[model samples]
Target: MTRSCVVSVGLLLLAVSTLTYGQGLLVVTDPDQVVRLPRPILIWPPDRPVVRPEPPAAYKIKQLEVNARLLDQVAQVQVSQSFTNTGSRQLEVAFLFPLPYDGAIDSMTLLVDGKEYPARLLKSDEARKLYEQIVRKNQDPALLEWMGTGLFKTSVFPVPAGETRTVSLRYSQLCRQHDGLTDFLFPLSTAKYTSHAVDEVSFRVTIESAQEIKNVYSPSHSVEIKRPDDNHATVTYKTKNEVPTEDFRLFYDVGKGKVGTRVLSYRPDEDDEGYFLLLAGPKIESKDNEHQKKTVMFVVDRSGSMTGEKIEQARGALKFVLNNLREGNLFNIVAYDSEVESFRPELQKFNEETRKAALGFVEGIYAGGSTNINAALRTALAQLQDSKRPSYVLFLTDGLPTVGETKEMQIVDNAKEANDVRARIFAFGVGYDVNSRLLDKLAREGFGQSQYVRPNEDIEDSVSRLYRRIESPVMTDVTIEFAFDEKHEELGKPVSRVYPKGSFDLFAGEQLVVVGRYKKAGPVKVTVRGSVAGEEQKLDFPAKLARHSEDETAGFIEKLWAVRRIGEILDELDLKGKNEELIEELVKLSTRHGILTPYTSFLADEDTSIRDTASNLRRADRRLSALAEPSGAGGF
Candidate 1:
């Protein structure tokens, strides 16, 4: 508890700092200083308190090409950008590359007229001082605040007028997984930082997995996916002379086992601490598993506040769940306002006849009256008394409890007491008026998750996405156990941390990735234990551990572990409120790993913190300059 609190405190502090420094750099220009550039050479958004000084010379991106390969769950990416001096005269440019959190740069090269220039990496602390020097000289505090974020900065390079320079960066990242899907995100929405769009931008990704590749989907951009077989797929995305407005996001599924699992480890050297990523999921076949049955209770709030589009969307969502209901599954819907109404008195078997009747009940649901969340949840929980089968409660609300036991905690407590069976409660909050904290608490206590839908988002989509994953759960109370033997003394303390912490139910077509640190690497034994159809079932698999490589193939594992660990800690911080120790540790983790959190953002409100940061940056920059100068000279 002490350790956890300290970590949380650190994160809160980091969040506060991030917000404060995020105000942006106020660029200042000195008529005498030719060394200073008015605008950032990189494409990051201007820091707050933004100052735009017309540059003596202008630069524009000509083209960009991104090539990526996914070997297992890790991705090796190369980004090359072409920049031309669009303005008159020769200009010295400070090239900047915004790096993904936890991403490590392997190599960088600058081609000025096809001749390579020298480049070096700077740690965050050193980079922070560099920004301070620029901000102090420019009188732009905004520049200093966000300057220290994970970045790859190259030395000043000369770009001749009408000449183009090509910059190529190579790096690697560990892709994260959720519910059997691995997502790769590229931060390509930099056109907003520039005045116009680039001429051409293209990206290609080739994925190879030990297990068969199942699905390849990209939601951000139009993409063409080619799959020669289940084990390999290639995706290509391109745009011609268009503004880059959104980031590129791709999600894919891998493996074919009923429960797909893979173990990846990374150690820096032959004898050092390492990290591991554990990916597991049920098979992605379209057919539902017949070995298990489920009882679903949908408790939806139809308060007067949900009279318009919200209620209609809710009805459509209910209809979707009914249509997707699996055979032999038991289901019911309970709609509540000040008064409670159930579609059926008891759980009804899912069939064509009952499905039609449920749709009728959904259509008859008219929004009116105040909210009675406590009573509504109680009524739904009462129907989930059967422990012989897996059960779930999909709760939706658009408002807080307004009538009958309005206290949020009391309502959650009462629902907990009513639910004797270990049923998962998936809660959804519609629009901003809903109490997110209450829903989160309810879901957490009920061994489930809480989702919030903004006013602009469709409720039907959010509910349907979740329903599809839970529609066919193959295992309940799922637990993973790792064993080590004397031959593999390097395996260390097997599992350091799991995001969800304890045992969780596993649904078909869904995957879970567990990230943690390990002391050594070698072969290890892993066992997955879960309850299937109320019977205990277990499977054993063999996995091998590895060390980190300079090629970046396995280097991202440590950073991936840090990301998941930080997310888990942030979730805890949200539930437990502010703790000094936790905030302190969070800051340490964020600073070391370059992970950004809401509490530690670059935007700011307080003046004292900014002043202190600026002062420190100035001192550090002076010291750094002194160290770089010749022994005879005071500074460069």
Candidate 2:
């Protein structure tokens, strides 16, 4: 028997995009929206799997179910979907899933004809090449983006003329926090991209926290919430036969204090080293602890390039910050281009009269001259010499240094020296042309973080969102230490790097998640230390290390650790030009677990396959290790 097959590359894209990070089953969408597996037209005998030639009039999504659990800030999600075959022919197909940014797919299962099949993970380059070949042969622009992103692949055979096949995927990621809230997003807009209306879509999320849960809200979808107690809540959403144009998004805040400490760990094998994630923060203090007063300074860059909407947005953001300053808090604004100007001669207390005057001052600023980033930072830092108060400098810039201290590194170093008062420098890069390395280095040196906004995003929104998190400082100069005994010393340092990568101030209603490695696993105690209102405070949390490799609760720890670690590598690459060692490490980590970083994507070029590159690297690494070892006869 002979048979011919032609699969729809569009349908394959629907499958891939559905795996985006979040807690729920992603419905498949149109081909143009996401990169997808190549459609292969095959001619073979009847026994082999074959694609159908005719396109279905309507490709309807039958069902979607999402189950998610949060252990502190880490989310573990399971997604299950039923994609029906409406056409009247026995067809063979493979459903593909693209990994969400900074997320790792742990496992996948496919069910067909009452049997289950496991899925496979492919290297980015290998996957990209496969899709590219299909795109070239079939002229499918839809598969282009799939080139570098890691993916999960599963196959189903013999659809039997009107049957449905199910795919289930389990994955996890570290939820990002802004201000006091953690945001969770699920890609659920695929139904709108499909040919037909989705029959049903549903989502359920179970939140568990040691602290009291507050303000569980969804901005993207209307949801019903059920709270059995302060520490637990369940949220659900469902709809029938409708188009979904937006992804599902939810935000929730957990109260601070004793309830804020949590431990999440993962180990794939007992023989292998394990990884751990720790989150700790202080609760809202009473009058006795007294929240510390904060001093905030905004350094705005109104260079010639920001003459249009960019400068207006920056001014709007400054106004928003002034209006929201806490009472008794000290604040100031500095607008600079070729020359620097200040709202007041010095920082002033936040009050109605000053805020009103500040708003007026912001409106008078206009974009002109060249960018003087060095002097701008110096002027802002000059007023923040008070060590007793927690100070923050929100530096906003849209272009590179053009007027004074034109060198990027010199400006970063100067900024570091001027920040002697320990003001956290949260940098905002408004456009693509700004030097990202300078911003990143500045933030790292000043004990803060850097954020980037594209041309389409609103700078005001980004600035306002960041202000909320730092609005109410409860703890400052936070440090974490793990209790190690004589028995634990043999295992070496258990922690390699904590996410955020340095000491930070902890605000009220906020939690910190730290990732690290351990040489050995056993019972352990962790301590969090910080200063509140210029007084030292300490808290301890009890956590027992997972003894074996199959600790279900900690399965996602390793992936989250890799995400942060890869981020560090990227930072280094940005700061100190690219290197072979860094690129090799990035490619290896990405291929092993599908972490999609810009470096990994760049390394996955058309000239060579990522998997082959990784394999060659491993062989070379082994050879180097062997050469470095000392011979018994020659060793002293």
lDDT of each: 0.63, 0.64
Error of 2 at 338 (Å): 7.7
Candidate 2 scores a C-alpha RMSD against the true structure in Å of: 11.5
- In model 2, pairs of residues that clash are 179-469, 256-283, 257-283, 265-554, 266-554
Q: Evaluate model 1: give its TM-score.
A: 0.61
The whole-model C-alpha lDDT of candidate 2 against the native structure comes to 0.64
Q: Each model's number of backbone clashes?
A: 45, 5
lDDT agreement of model 1 with the native: 0.63
Error of 1 at 311 (Å): 3.4
